[model samples]
Target chain A: MPKLPKPPKPPSYSEVRGTVQDNVIWKSIFRPGSIYRKGYRDTSRDRALAAMNNVLYHLHPVKVKRHGLKLTYTYCLGGLSFFMFILLTITGIFLMFFYTPAAGAGAEIAYLNMRELSTTVTFGALVRNLHRWGAHAMVFLVFLHMARVFYHGAYKPPREFNWVVGVILLLLTLFLSFTGYLLPWDQLALWAVTVGTNIAGFSPVFGDQVSFVLLGGLEIGPETLLRWYVLHVLFVPFITVVFLAVHFWRIRKDGGISGPL
Target chain B: MSDEVQMDQEVYDRLIGEGKSERIARAKAKAAAVRKSKIEEGATLGPKPAEEATKALEEFRSSRSGGGGVATKTAAPADGGGGGRLTPEERAARVSASLGNGGDSGSVGVPAASDHTHRLLALVPPAGIQQVQSKQQDKVYTWPHLLLVEFVALLAAGSLLLVASFFLDAPLGSLANVNEVPAINKAPWYFMGLQELLAYFHPAVAGITIVGAAVLLLMSLPYVDKNPSAKPENRKFANMAFTFFLAFWGILTIIGSFIRGAGYEWVWPWVQGLGFVL
Candidate 1:
């Protein structure tokens, strides 16, 4: 009564006469044939598969035109600008962790925090330098990208809307740089922003109001620092990221970097 | 017969042969056939309005009947009447019609003589031509090529920035004091061009009016220019205008960065200065 039929055995690799290797242990670390799952064929097909399967690669088409591939044609200025933006974002976040944006804290305290960050925080100096240099580079690169588009006569017809968006992006990039200029609370940052905001003061009917809104007062001080802080850290960055997404999407829609008409 | 009368006759004869009454045929022919000239004719020559043509045709027919003149016997071939050779008179009339009309309306397989008409037609292309252009145009995929170029560009820029960061610490002056102003207070480098403009022109003009106007104009360039050509060689005026703008910005930026010193005074780059130098 207690004797039951032997349970059916599960299939084993040995039954298939395949040599058993410890591929399972290695499989956890490396995916064997994950890319060539359907079986490797020609290079062209593999390249196509690589582009189709990968998220980043798929943003591009399967093959670029020969002229489009020319380094000088685009100089990849737009890409450099974007890459620098990403670098700035990363390093900027790191700087923020150590940054103190107290409105009441005198520029002395603000400057002290920067010094402390460089001396105390690990890799803090590198992060700060990267953010600063990358930001400057981005400004230059974006301008170069615009120049390239202009000279290539790429803004004609279908690309008109994208060009307008790009112009807006250019203005936004400037705003980003200007807002960040006030963060260090150093003399250069202070006077530069003061000069910039003063230019805003010259707007016809909005002059006084613009300056008042920007500086939070008649002059740069605690409130100005606070306002600039929020803009640099929150508002400007958020807007930039949104516009950046649109800009990249437009590049694809506008036929991927302009070449000969 | 006068050329005009002969053309009207040939066209009317062809149209009447298509089972139309003489009055109706004359009106239809006038609406459809273009009169050829040394230069290409404009598109305004189409058949007259139905009411006007009918009225005019009725007047002509009544006058002809009143005059008691007999209508000539014309050999108007039926549609697609292949191998029906034209009589000598018909052949001469057809040849003369073709020559007068530039062969566009009467002859099969002969292209229109006017390039301008083809160009005008190109403005509203046939749908099939659009697909043909896309197929024939040289194009490359964006996959490996675009992505790879982007990757290489990023790597190069990143490396250069990394190196520059190590050598050049981001500039930070003493703590800000609203009570005091820096000797060479200036806007960011990109805005240096406008700032330099402020030096020469009134702030309102330079800062607000000029800059604002320039930006608006730049934005409106594509619309206002209205030239369909993209090639620089074909657009000399546009190219020169843009180049002038670029040169102005470039020159101003340079002057602001290197030439201008404390209190916005001019100084050579090599001159000893107590402030920022490019």
Candidate 2:
């Protein structure tokens, strides 16, 4: 009988991993100093290079004051506020897929969309819950962050301008939340917004004009819904992001984190 | 300018006698002639004498002390106390002796007083140099240190939000009807404090003026409080005022959200059920 053919041997895990890591495509994906690269080690040079070569370099410096690492010092309020904003954006996008900004007269597409979103779509209710709660959390966090900065007196000297930027960001956050509140088109959303916008109508000289501009007519309607939807998803967020960039840039320019005191 | 330069015969002869090369001696003699002409045209040369510097320092110290200022003592020359003039060679010998080199054997190549022909390469102003006022601070790399903490914070917040989302469902009331108005209409919780203010003040005052003024004050806090200190002990009033504002707002918000019922009147949440929504 002829000798049985030997079964071919498979490549080892390490060999396959090595081949994948050494490929041109992988090398392009991870820059020269990336810790994800094949030869990375926990050396001082590699650690610095990891931060320097990454996209996060824009937000973080290569090194930070050691005291900033302490949880109580910052309570991580500002970072968490930013994280909540990101969370809300993601969840807001998911909701936008199922939502329609139409309302008024015979058509109530916006209200219909809200009902179907909570009932029919997969994970819709969960995402909506996260968006709502995260928005509230973000507003609360931003306020707490301001308070933290005040108590620490981190708003002194070179940081004073950044504090003003921060206040603007806080106002933007509130506007974002208020606009989103009206999107649900429920009694709670409509009347809450009516009460909120009525305050804008009280602005001394331009009261009537501002109210008309906000409502798109004399009161809440399909036009108002569309206008606010754009503000919530696009206009306000765009402005907030611009200010966020400046705020983070100033933090680095003004000598990193504040004091041990 | 080159044609006008004339070599000083006396300087050339002295340099030659001191064993300098012909090229160096000739260059030095020409430079000396140029310097002499410049001096004749009113150019100043060299620094003030050590005695003058010592006298100025003494006078400054005395004036500062007389004005109740802290007197700063600098290291004045050991032999400068006599206030007597010394030749360049004697001064060089004293400097060398102070440095533990001493006498002619280790004289450090002091040039003669008349050697004013030495080239002036450049004059750098004091302001041209950088002054480092801050000392070294304790720091750590951001990659594993700060980024790791941030990652953990992100995970914690994300997980908490996820758990909340899983357990709780967002509220959805009946469709909006312009014809129907609810008995207890209120703003979102964040604006509840302002809404609560509506009970006591006019809408314009409670809503627009007060809110606007609060925001303006918050934005201008840094400029307003001119205190330079970051320490809490130095800013008691600022802290107290802010804390009071927070407490006032907090109380109003709580009253508006939980303790108020139909017609915006007060009622305990335990009895009326929560009239608020997120």
Candidate 3:
């Protein structure tokens, strides 16, 4: 029998071969090895590699114990807190574009900016609300996460250091909220911060100095607004990010979420 | 194979750091390697001969029972595991070896599941995961399990905030006038607890001493309690104490938030119209 003509073989992907398909535009984006090969075994090692190789996924363990994954056990309160932080960061940046931290006239410039943001700027109110609510949610969720950790006795033994770090994060969260409280320069913001700073004034030794430093003077005025604006925008976020990184790294060091004994 | 051996060494060292016996650690590493090799050889490669399977199971069982292993926790060094007398120098050597050769310094904290839990839940893999032998428990890859859940939560929380933002603008009271402070001025809900404390004690006592003491106590909990176990049942006293603290915080916050009238006076929440509810 006469042999049929052989079909052409596909060229290889190597640079040496210089295949047309290899130089295709899409190939540049989704390179080989980016996705796992088909029929890959879900073995323990494979799972470990999957987690270790990814950036975001690296926060989690390859194979968590069933007990640890239970919604009731963790309630994902820590995750919620983290999500709120991300939301606040994004919305806070959006807010900074419009807000002016100046104490001008009866209707303060800051208050006018806020009013404009709420009533005029497109989706401005949404961004402001998200920031406001996210702040509240983060404060609530951080405390809830702490409560969950306490209830589960997860702060014991190998996990002790992480718990201490978490407590510090909680304090940082409150400071973030308090510093942010004065940003709007409204009656609510003014009196709330005054009440808060006045408490600082009662601290005996450094009370007056502390309040003075916080207000940038003895009273809540332009200096106070400027000081708070810098704190809310620049200083607090930087410190929070640093501590957050440590808090997460320590969790990975102390073992995945604590489970049954 | 070399990579697996390196990983095994890392695990063994970590276990040792957690106070496990060398013998038990070796057995666990061996069992894990066996499981890995079996997975690498696909199930279609053919079933294990009955005699070999029986022998493997018997060896695994013996190694576990003989080496003082339990379901969830490894044998405690102070209790059942041998090598409780491991010299400090030996431990330091093991730590250095693991740190040097493991190549996994940054990759710690994987909780190897308890053998009993693994065996019982080994029947079915969680959704979206590739199939492996059932010897491992019902495990799901974290990509889908954790990250997916987090993404969904982000969307849920974001949308909720979106709707809320539309209906309820963030509160911005009239422009600041220090001389005309609102009659019922109060701090945010969170600081309301502290504000309530201020009403009861001197500002120094309430703000600095009491609040500072609470924070310090919280930070030093693990050191102060000294309980090694993570189980809730074993931590009743600590739980009760925290519950009381939370109750105090909650009640004080409520008083500061709602019960206090113009002069920070106590008024039943019902006295105010339901419209006063936040």
**Residue ranges of candidate 3 with Cα displaced over 4 Å:** A1-49, B1-139, B274-278
**What lDDT does each candidate get?**
0.73, 0.88, 0.76
For candidate 3, lDDT tens digit of each residue in A1-261?
999999888655553333433455645553332234332345655556666665654477666666766678788899889888988889998999999898856546888899999889988988888888889889999999999999888888788899998998999999999999998888888888999999888777888898899999989998899999999889988998998898888787776677665
Docking class of 2: medium
Candidate 1: where are CA atoms >4 Å away? A1-42, A103-108, B1-133, B137-143
Q: How well does candidate 2 score on lDDT at residue B180? A: 97
Q: Per-residue lDDT for B1-278 in model 1, tens only?
A: 23253245677888777788877876656544445431255544556666665465345444444443544233545334222344465455445444554322544333445443322232345765555235454655454466667787788878888898888777777878778877788877888898899888878888899989988887777678777787878878888888899899999988887788888899886784534621
Worst 10-residue lDDT window, candidate 2 chain A: A32-41
Worst 10 residues of 1 chain A by lDDT: A30-39
Residue A39 alpha-carbon offset, candidate 2, angstroms: 0.9
Alpha-carbon shift of residue A45 in model 3 (angstroms): 6.7
Candidate 2 residue spans exceeding 4 A from truth: A1-13, B1-131
Q: In candidate 1, what are the lDDT values of residues A85-167, reduced to their tens digit?
A: 88888898888888887645434566788888778999888889898878888899988898888878888877888888888
List per-candidate RMSD values in Å: 18.2, 13.6, 20.9
In candidate 1, position B171 carries an lDDT of 76
Which one wins by TM-score: 1 or 2?
Answer: 2
TM-score preference between candidates 2 and 3, better one: 2
